[model samples]
Target chain A: MPSLIWFNEDSLNPEHQMVKDYADAPKVYVFDAPYLQAQNIAKHRIQFIYEALLEIPSIQIYKGETVAVLLQLIKDLAISEVVTTETPNHMIKGWQNELQKSIDLVTYPEIFPVTDHSSPRRFSRYWRKHERSWLTV
Target chain B: MMQQLRTDLELADREAIATYLQSEFPFVEDSGELSPHVGGRTAGLVRLQSFRLEKYGKQRNFLDGEVSQLSPYVSRGCLELEELRQWALKQSRSKSVEAFVSELAWRAFFHLVYEEEGDRILKDMEKPKVPMNQHQRSLPEDIAAGTTGIPSMDTLIHMLKETGYLHNHARMYLASYVVHFRKVSWRAGADWMYSLLIDGDFASNHLSWQWVASTFSTKPYIFNRENLERYAGSLLPGDPKQGDPFNYSYEELAERLFEGAYMPEPSGRSPGQYQ
Candidate 1:
């Protein structure tokens, strides 16, 4: 089964683990126009994302409904594996949930990991768990 | 329909990106080329290399502080926080990098909150510390227009619009003026700021506003004329009396701003304390 890597807004880094491991796979990044317009995302936000997209090489960029784009591509490209990095974005999560109905979406762990352990509600507790390790390791 | 963006040119220069964006996204009005912080993995790497840990600790709080300017890349995930922390430690394990690392930790903390709470961060995590029963939920037209006539507030709004960047102090002052002085909900200010910022991250921007509004913290983050003048004195006039709006002392401002009679906390530092 061929893999199709999708770089969501949160993980646009060229050196992202998914981008690295699937270097040879077909990749795409969507602008999610509906989400942007609905959220009242300013022009500057799009400007910055375009600037970032200019960096990621060989990825197909599109503007429209995100899930529709991915679903169309899945049928058009015969994509068996859909991969992307993790994000807390409400829109992206919504699309991922929709995508899962048709395909098993692969979400890698976040790019930046403070600690492998789970975080407490407060930063103090989270820091206390790893400050010594953070300083030393 | 999902329309594919044109990739005819390499998009190597600002002119190309601007032209491409105009053609590809006609809906979003092009505001000319972005600030010097263009995105790319290579740019992110270069930005990380310029961190001044030693100076960042002390000067980071001021308007003219020595910021690494790595915010756009960091927020976009063009650069990894762990990589920067390792690089800083390699420079020197001394307390220099600790402050810089803590700033990164704040972002991480927000990220964790978003991940764990799953959209809960968008709403108030805790009840309002100060009485906000009657606070307006709308952002004033003057604020969005950047014509507040208060020099400091106006300048901050202009910075956010023109450059999509604001000094942490400037952000606090602007947020305080909106959430506290103007008596508007932090959500309104956060939405307006988040929409305009080039480095806008929901977890960071929204949560920070909640911090200022005292929705997610033990106390509200308030500032007086002295604190504002100390950090952004240049924006204000020499005569403190001329600083309309924010001309009062801390006590007076608190009395005027807060509604119900309640004891004020010193806003002491917690591990999660913003800035």
Candidate 2:
């Protein structure tokens, strides 16, 4: 069964490392109507995403409820699995849970370096601890 | 089984994208073309390559600073902060790059705060170090109109409305003016700025406003005419045709804006510490 790679805003680049990892899979990006409506994201931002989408070749764009779109695509294409890059978003986590119920879903770890310490509320404290580890030449 | 709900959704060009967005989200007014700053991965790469890290550190605060106008791309995830950092380090290995790198770190820091604290970043991170003058939750119509009677701020507001961009120093000044001087809540000011900015990120924009409002800092950030002249004087041509509201010293500004709601630090802590 074929698999689909869903691209979130954080992982939009066609050259994203995760996209290379899923080279043979068909790619899809949903406008995520619920999230857009809930966030009331600015028009300029949507324009930016629209421009970015135009750059990617052979990718599908969907505009509707995220889980519903995924389910429809899965059934229509006989997709056995779904994959996407991991994000810190709680909403995405919720979507991932629903998507996992019907199909094999895999989320790659975030592309950036991870700190051993938990993220701190104060930037000064977080910087004091993590800068030495991450900011080296 | 796959129904083609919208294969026609492929936006052919910039014009098509604008039309689709306008029709789909009729509530949001069209802001016209974004600044010459291009979008997409290719453009992002070009921007990263063109940035001069050494100059950026020395001049980023000025109105015409040698800043890397990459925030829009970075915030949109067209370019990653780590990628930019690596590129900067590769180009030049010097402490000069620290300022530019720290700005990127601030972006990452804001994201971390948002991820961990979630919506709570929208509120005060800590109780105000100085008592706030309890103002309205909504932004004042005059400020939104860009007719605040302060020449520098009005000019900045006009530029923000016309071009979806503002200098970092200008942003802090405006944020300070709105939250502290005008006595508007930071949430109101943050919402207004986020809506207008092309580089708008919920984490960075709101959190920075909180920083200015003294909610996320040890003291509220305020600026007066002399500070503005040092950074933006060249850009702000002509005299204050209107009454110059911001033409005051630090003590006078603090006294007038805060109206006894603020107290001066005892002993060694000078008034300059507020800025």
Candidate 3:
């Protein structure tokens, strides 16, 4: 039941905890075709992601339906857990929901310390709440 | 089954990446030269290293300013917000750094809202502060094709498709023209802009358009010719025509666009104002 690290666009950092904890895990990055078509992502954005994937030499890159591909990999490789970063994308959330039914998922917390309830209605208030804490540190 | 992209990350360079992309995704526009901005952590760090923390605050609002141009990296998660903050601190604690930090905070704020609102962020979150339901539900040919007659806006649109980068103020100006002047739905303009930007985050791009449209904020953002002249300086031909649509003052433009709607008194010391 070896684990696999799934790197999404928002979670490309190889230095992140997931990459560290799953040091020997088989890592994968996907260019989700349906998601790209649905979002109408163009060449410039895709090239940037491709360049980023080039940075992490260990991850296997693919172009396909992301959830189906990851699930297939999980089944083929006997992966018991799928680890990834918590991205706020609703589509990614849907993928997580689908993937979770089949295997345990370890999601890294959002890069920034924020929760739905904690967010202020206005940026000014949000800044006021977080300013000193940010400045002091 | 996933088609594993045939690329050896260590052996491949930009050309190799471009080749693979061309083969795998033929439908996407192959903007021949690919992106001018290089990706990877090294490029992101170099950008961070060269960032002018001081000029950022005073000049960030201009078309040609010391903006970090880091959004592309940040959006891809190649750069972290904390790293940016810490780097800015080492530069200085002046108002410029604070201003730069505030800008960064703006993106996170959008994400916070995005998390809360989910896909609803794509829709109008609140009643638009003005009457705009009649605006075009879809983009028009001229605007979509970037032949909108307004030179500044058309130039911005060309720059958007070509470079996948635009000054934030240019974006506001474009959004205002699309949302208010053309009377198109903010959603339409937002989706178009979001799709093209290299730094496009659905939350930041969409929410900013919503802010400009007065759907997410208290008032709609608009700019006049004189204001555009000050900031857009030299980016356009200095010879602005008298009959140009944006040549009017804020008061005149507001009356022209939102006539009969309740609007505050017109006033501005700059290129644009939110009323």
Candidate 4:
């Protein structure tokens, strides 16, 4: 089975909250690296995740890192499919493009289900306010 | 950097406290002994909450000691805004009470923007549809010093410098003046505010500065001397009728109607992997 991982940072959305909110129950893993100093943990984790992606070639990663972090994470994870709620702020858009080179990225508009949304569209072309009937799908 | 930042950071914290006091308690003159409100201490909160029922709304507009000084605490999470929102909603279900709740929601919204956007909220990415001077202007020390020579703004400058607090109205005024009258970049003002406001969360200050600069909001924010005098009239002591009721000497009003002044800065460069 393909594994799904949630990178937890305890922002407005945390791992526990993500587990509850996300409709699909993917295999959840919390990346832990206590051996590294607190300051280096984030960077080390990215490096670790990247190395793991190269070896396993089966793990799928979902992320919420800062834009800069996401850039490196995408290359490291070798992610082929991304599913996330739309962000009005553009940093996440940057991550979507980086992953697009090799993987499939999908996003549900913030006003989900009601908003006509389609996966695989880049943020720039992701039009706002699609027809209601299409969104119901 | 710590030593260089020592005074500025201290000033920031002090200003945050000051801003909270000024906004919440415009009537109190003394900064007497008060216990910590957070870290398991409830003394300060209890004392602050004592005035919540009366002056929280009634004296909010009064510049002196009429409002609640809890904003900095709320902004920095020293005090939970959700608690305040719930308390206020319970106290009075009227529009006035709801207004306070809405203000708290705005803080949450600012945090949400940053939580979702991260550092990109600070970057300028959107290319203005209309071309103009692309140069960035440095922030003025006087403005930062709150010494722009505008009498009406003196309270704001004094609050920011001496205490670290600026009235909510004062914040709107100063931000508008800095972004419009002074024609300074919102980033500079925001940076200076962050450096000096203890309660300065990246989201709240940044978005608010942009809001007043008309960079984040669709409408241009402005304040005239008459408007200021009218709002703050009853707050000043003794001779409430004092000061210019119509006009005050400050930057002359202009009608340039600038564009591309309200959009958020763009996030980092987008990746090439489009669907």
Q: Per-residue alpha-carbon lDDT of model 1 for B25-86, expressed as tens digits?
A: 67764556466666666877776667667787767766776777877777777777777767
Using DockQ as the measure, which candidate wins?
A: 3
lDDT (tens digit, per residue) of candidate 4 on A1-137: 22133332211122223334444523222222221222122221222222222222122333223333434444555544444433433333554566456555455432222222232121212322222222222
The C-alpha local distance difference test score for the whole of candidate 3 amounts to 0.80
lDDT of 2 by residue, B118-144 (tens): 677778888876666477799899898
Q: Which residue runs of candidate 1 sit more than 4 Å off their true CA positions? A: A111-118, B29-33, B234-240, B260-275
Residue range B1-275, candidate 3, lDDT tens digits: 68898656443467777777888898787667667777767788888889777788788877887889998888888888777777776775798988877777788788889888888999988888888979999989898778877778788888888777788888998898899989999999998888788788888899899999888887778887888888887697543486688887667777898984746455545333221
The predicted structure with the larger TM-score, 1 or 4, is 1
- Place model 4 in a CAPRI quality band: incorrect
Interface RMSD of the candidates, in order: 2.2, 3.5, 2.1, 17.3
Candidate 2 residue-wise lDDT at A85: 73
Which runs of model 2 end up more than 4 angstroms from their true locations?
A34-40, A89-104, A111-120, B1-13, B145-151, B237-242, B260-275
In candidate 3, position B197 carries an lDDT of 84
Q: Candidate 3, which segments miss by more than 4 Å at Cα?
A: A113-116, B9-13, B238-242, B270-275
Off by over 4 Å in 4: A1-137, B1-44, B54-62, B124-136, B233-275
Better of 3 and 4 by TM-score: 3
Itemize residue pairs with steric clashes in candidate 2. A76-B1, A76-B2
DockQ, structure candidate 1: 0.59
Chain B TM-score per candidate, please.
0.89, 0.86, 0.93, 0.66
